[model samples]
Target: MTTSPTTISVPADHVLVWSDEFANDGLPDATKWVHETGRNKEGWYNNEKQYYSGPRLENAQVHNGVLTITARKESNSDQTDWGGQAYSSTRLATLGKKDWTYGFFDIRAKLPCGKGTWPAIWMVGSRGAWPAGGELDIMEWVGSKPERMFSTVHTTAGSGGNGKGADAPIADACNTFHNYQMYWTAQQVIFAVDGKVHFIYKNPGTGVDAWPFDAPQFMILNVAIGGDLGGAVDDAVFPVQMDVEYVRIYQKSK
Candidate 1:
């Protein structure tokens, strides 16, 4: 069963606590991001076919006020842990750098448009594991269907195919940049594109299994190539990239 999100304009006051404008022209600020390149032994979840390259400028870089994450049709056979995936990409996360319990997030990005390409901006609880810990997928997109975007909430109560979430259509998703946003509070979590709210999950008033958002969660941004969501890739589009303009976070001040 899918959890339906409500639509309402509930404005909450907040102050900017952190942000990245991509003003630097080099690797993402180490203080803000780390290249998460450790899962080659067991292989990535969702049967993804990409070797996440660490600190590789060719795969992830910043220039002209934009952070570009590129997924190239190349193999990193040199790495001892390389999973032998057919493509190489980057996964950047604010795991150790920053984590939040509740806040307002704004991520402006232009998705890549190549069959098999999967890009996502999501969050996970810092102190828990897997579905029980809680996962908030702010946005997930597959290139094959450029018009559709997804947002889901995963928990021990429901995850994977059972995850409760929703999808919305964007006519120019691949062609233009859009602001993917999320508003998380003690009572509920709401997701939006640009200024339009599409998904909202309210506290079930049950227990942690249904509301793991009480703990700190960190954000992740990456372009995955082929797996469950991203069907078969068209090798013709070997070098697809996702351009991220900026990310901002705000929280209520004590």
Candidate 2:
């Protein structure tokens, strides 16, 4: 069962350090986000089909106080993807422009419904490689399963199919907006949806392999089309989207 927190408000003592309110319409704030382009050698590491496009309006855009990441069933003639599939999407990250060590990260968004859509709001350590650097998946939802959402943490010792993860049932996640949040510190990592805490990964304090999140990490937002976890694609869904209202981060009072 998920443990609900007493309150969802940012603690009175904490101060907002950074935020992207999407005040203006158009491309995302270049000062805060950069798009990860092309298809990875490992099919985006999960046999994903979509060819991640550049910073274009079709895939990534901000409008009317919301950031919309649209995934489309279209071909990318310029790039060669592993799946040989005709689809395109966007993966935006704050790698070098904005990376933080530990803080309270919060995002309010609505997921896309229909098979083949895999939307995620997650983070990764800024140093080392995958597994070694660590990953914190704040929110992950595959369209195949509309009633549940997942959270997971990956480390060198526990990664790939062996990662420590859990899920919570949220029946209307695709139609409603929810606060996907993470509270990280030197001691533990807590994952929550709205105000309810669903999972916690405690630092073993053994070595980097078990807890490689001691360093800085960056945020990532994307909507993948048909992957190992996304199952089959319902091309009829066509241009679906994950609508993000805002992203904010807070730190303890200084």
Instruction: For candidate 1, report its TM-score.
Output: 0.95
Off by over 4 Å in 1: 1-12
- In the order shown, the candidates' Cα RMSDs to the true structure are 2.8, 2.6
Best by TM-score: 1
lDDT of 1 by residue, 1-254 (tens): 66555442324668889999999999988999999988965689899999898887899999999999999998788888888788999999999999999988999999999899999999998996898889999999999998899999999999999988988889788779999989998888899998688888889989999999899999999999898989999999979999999999988877
lDDT of candidate model 1 versus the reference: 0.90
Q: Write one digit per residue (lDDT tens) for candidate 2, span 6-55.
A: 34556667789999999999999999998887444346768788878777
The C-alpha lDDT values of all candidates are: 0.90, 0.88
Off by over 4 Å in 2: 1-9, 38-42, 78-84
What TM-score does each of the candidates earn? Answer: 0.95, 0.93
